[model samples]
Target: MHGPGSSGWLLVTLCAATGAYCLLRMRSSVEEQRRAAAGEALMGFGMAAMAVPTAVFTPPAWAWPLWAAVFGAAGVHGLWAARASARHLHHVVGAGAMVYMAVVMAAGPRAAHHSTTAGIPALTAALLLYFTAYVLVTGARLVPVPAVAGGPGSTGPRTGPGAGWGDRPELARACRLSMGIAMVAMLLTM
Candidate 1:
């Protein structure tokens, strides 16, 4: 087991890793809603891990430009989905949080690694805390997915619980649960 010296950091890593596993499981599920939820959770994990290294440790000057481009791409792409997922509170909030994280990290992400500077570390700490809360709260929301009831004649998906594998509602719930646990763990660490 990884030592406990950096429990906080370890939790952060664990959440990210577990989130990834859940995503993979989601994909393999015999359900479509599960697939979509897995996919969305993967995106959430990506956003959370984007600037983690920068948040936890200082990097060489060369790292800035590289990270800048990476975070910039993530922010821009997340914005692209921002409009469509606007109706989705989880998506909206999560995407917005990612943008905010990108901005904070880009502003000067290596302070904690360098000379004493409370501002950067303070900001990082605050951002981590906020996002952690966001992940926990948002993950609780229930998204509806359609499920196919009966037989092939009624192959279409229907709402409500008991939706079988490959159904929309089933997929939706799985996505939420998976994302929720991952985010909650992440937030707790922060």
Candidate 2:
């Protein structure tokens, strides 16, 4: 999974781009959106860094523990935030997955290479299932719903200009869907 190759680079690019978009989302006027985007930005960048090809640049011994520590803190923060909004629960899961991966990587080169034997199979399977379900559900939610003409809930094409890019809900959902897919890919490679 960490081999130096085009696929690895593609994963890096995808994650970094997602992180950048999440950073943009942090500019939203909504306080909740800002907080959520901040957490997502952290996840995206963290994933990008962790996805770096091992053959090209294996991290120093200390880096793995640091990665685990950072994501562990993020997970704790997610748990706290989840009290206010259920959506933050997903962040907690993502953070926990990152910590798990980091710990596995820290085990040693042999452990990293033999991922099947290194980590607990059941835990990995559970994480994979969670991410897979998340991807499917988010993808389904992305489907556009047709508006009925003159319906009670119809606002008639949203007066004035549309929302700014950072405030657009559809794009946010797409961003999340992309991350979920990326997480699945990462876990499968593990």
Alpha-carbon error at 104 in model 1, in Å? 2.7
For candidate 1, the TM-score is: 0.43
Where does model 2 exceed 4 Å of error? 112-120, 152-162
Lowest-lDDT window of 10 residues in candidate 1? 111-120
lDDT of 2 by residue, 16-127 (tens): 9999999999988778889889988899998899888877888998998999999999999999988888888999999999998899889975664563554546677899
Clashes of each: 9, 0
lDDT of 1 at 99: 47
**Pairs with steric clashes in candidate 1:** 31-166, 33-171, 34-171, 145-168, 145-169, 146-168, 146-169, 147-157, 147-158
lDDT of 1 by residue, 1-190 (tens): 1113455455456556546655655644355445345546555565345425434555465654554455455445556655666434455444444444444444552522332265334544564566566545545545334546774536554544544343444444555554555544433232
Q: State the displacement of the C-alpha of residue 143, model 1, in Å, after optimal TM-score superposition.
A: 14
